[model samples]
Target chain A: MIAKQTNQKAWFMVLPVFLVVAFSAVIPLMTVVNYSVQDTFGNNVFTWVGMDWFKDLIHSERFHAAFLKQLMFSGIILLIEVPLGIMIALAMPKKGWGVPVCLISMALPLLIPWNVVGTIWQIFGRVDIGLLGHSLASLGFDYNYTQDPIAAWITLIIMDVWHWTSLVVLLCYAGLCSIPEAYYQAAKIDGASRWSVFRYIQLPKMQRVLLIAILLRFMDSFMIYTEPFVITGGGPGNSTTFMSIDLVKLAIGQFDLGPAAAMSLVYFLVILLLCWVFYTVMSNIGEESSNGGK
Target chain B: MNFNWMAWTAPTASFFGIIFCLLVIMTIWELKCPGGGPRIGILRFETTRGDRLFVSLLGSAFIHIFWLALFPGLSLYWALVFSCIYALAVFRWV
Candidate 1:
């Protein structure tokens, strides 16, 4: 047996990282907290307002609408992306020269910068000069994302699906690839049906990655800003105004610092709570299943 | 030294101060008694002391926010009391 040496120098090693995180995250967060509870005029003059901002935000009809719309967008995105990703992953080549080609193509969308993605989609959805818009117009389908709420939403959703479904596909592919050949061999020897093999073997194997995929997708879609912002600019009306877009409008456009700060805290807290719940439940399920296996 | 940009307010400062103090206390406690093992509670999920603390703090934030929203004219002291009780219950069982 070996005794581990305790070195106080480890604290010194950790100091740089601690300082970096404190400066980047903690300071900004403290500032946000300060702003949330205080009303401010332009010259950095501030007055304490206590919980007024939070109260107003919670009761605001505008806030409620944006939140509900955000929820629906994320819900629709997940409902589309996850299953589509899994199906794509299943259909992809397992080996040989085709694997690299498929992988590269899948990775391309993810590599594009977020703002660039937004710009691309913006231009891509324009009725005057865009392929998609022109094609739809030529086909006699009434589709103008600039004017129509449903068209705006469908374009945004489809753009997100195109951009991010690859992530889910890649994660699921890794999960699928990890399944040992012996499991398939065993299933084959037993004359197990394809559906049964997938249901019992593949699904369970993908659970961990699926948890990661869902959490990432949920958080990303929940806080989505760039693509939708560029494409629709929160609308012909306020129809596409997701929470983040509305927050930006309040904070930047209206310069309502107190309310915006309060809204930011609430938004952050919602994400934190939901992520915590998702992580705990999924990990518990994993633990129970592993225990049963043992 | 030059933290004027942060626009520090008393309430927010104290909030961070208390959180910092809680973290330090938890660290000391962990040093004194190692291994805060996961325990399944009423929630039917495994959580350690740190997890319980996180959950309590998060729950307290919601309670305070909700209290402000629902009881606009009321003092926040009652909300603090409720949060304290919530924390105690969480530490005891969850």
Candidate 2:
């Protein structure tokens, strides 16, 4: 059923969400803004600084590299996970016992904490002991993520793919399931090939969910840490450090509160900006889709 | 209370903030997804409200504590085994 059209009073249904998001997001955000504009000693005493931290952060090579690395990593993750997830989801059974088993198993990786996902892969890729590492080494390959830059990057990308592709799969599956059976019946009667049927029918139906999946994955991957931090510790030589990793190091490790806060606001803004763009684009598509149906 | 408005309060505040957000999410979810399971997925393996509360709390606790209590010499594989056992118990009994 279309969402209840009770004179927009239904927005009250969204009240719980707003309260939660505001608490989780707004307070910390206010603090981050406070820090970004000021310098402080060990005590609660604070001194006013201007845009100095933002200026310094903007010019920092380390921040630039981390930012570029995050952008690239997010791009790569989106490219790999979205299509692969769609393919796997397409292969899944629509009905019967297999459907549930497959969906739950795929989701298993996602339910694991992000830090643990990293640790699992860290162990899973150990050349001496990790399943992937040991298998590769036994098969006579020189594979060491700790020492090899390419291997480290590959391991991280693959680990991410394994962990998050299920989210895309579930979203796509929901979209697919929502397609009326009449569309398939119409296609069969019209003698449309299976490939044509999928391209014209299923893909269009899934666009909004896929857009959400892509956008969520992009933001999350761009800011990803905890896992990579546990696994690679942002090293061999800064190869795996994303923007979020750099932010944590600045804020907590070095205690450079001013610049860290600056970077974080920028970081959060970048995510918000991208999400807005994605939201608008998807809404347009939804509008067009509804228009088409009429 | 003399609230140390800057440092000591941030972590605790953030933690409680997460809980409050999650509670609101749970409530909205209960309204939206009434009659238990989400619109998609298996019902037999479905987590009830009690099980869901247990899983989220237990999982988060594991995230915080797993690094602390590992035996000094235990292998990563052993740790994984222990985690899998924990997941099983949460899944089956929680």
The weakest ten consecutive residues by lDDT in model 1 chain B span B2-11
- Over all chains combined, what TM-score does candidate 2 have? 0.72
Q: Estimate, for each residue in A1-294, the C-alpha lDDT of model 2 and write its tens digit.
A: 688654767789999998998789876776776777678776676666755676677667888899898988998999999999888878889999999899899889989998888889999999988999999999999989999978989999999998999999999999999999999999999999989988889988988889889888987898788888998999879998888888888889999887888888778766765675566567667767767878
Clashes of each: 0, 0
- Candidate 2 residue pairs in backbone clash: none
Candidate 2 segments whose C-alpha is farther than 4 A from its true place? A1-22, B1-94
Docking quality band of candidate 2, CAPRI definitions: incorrect
Pairs in clash, predicted candidate 1: none
What are the candidates' individual DockQ scores?
Answer: 0.82, 0.05
Give the interface RMSD values of the models in order: 1.0, 16.6
Share of native interface contacts recovered by each model:
0.79, 0.11
Per-residue lDDT of A259 in model 2: 82
Docking class of 1: high
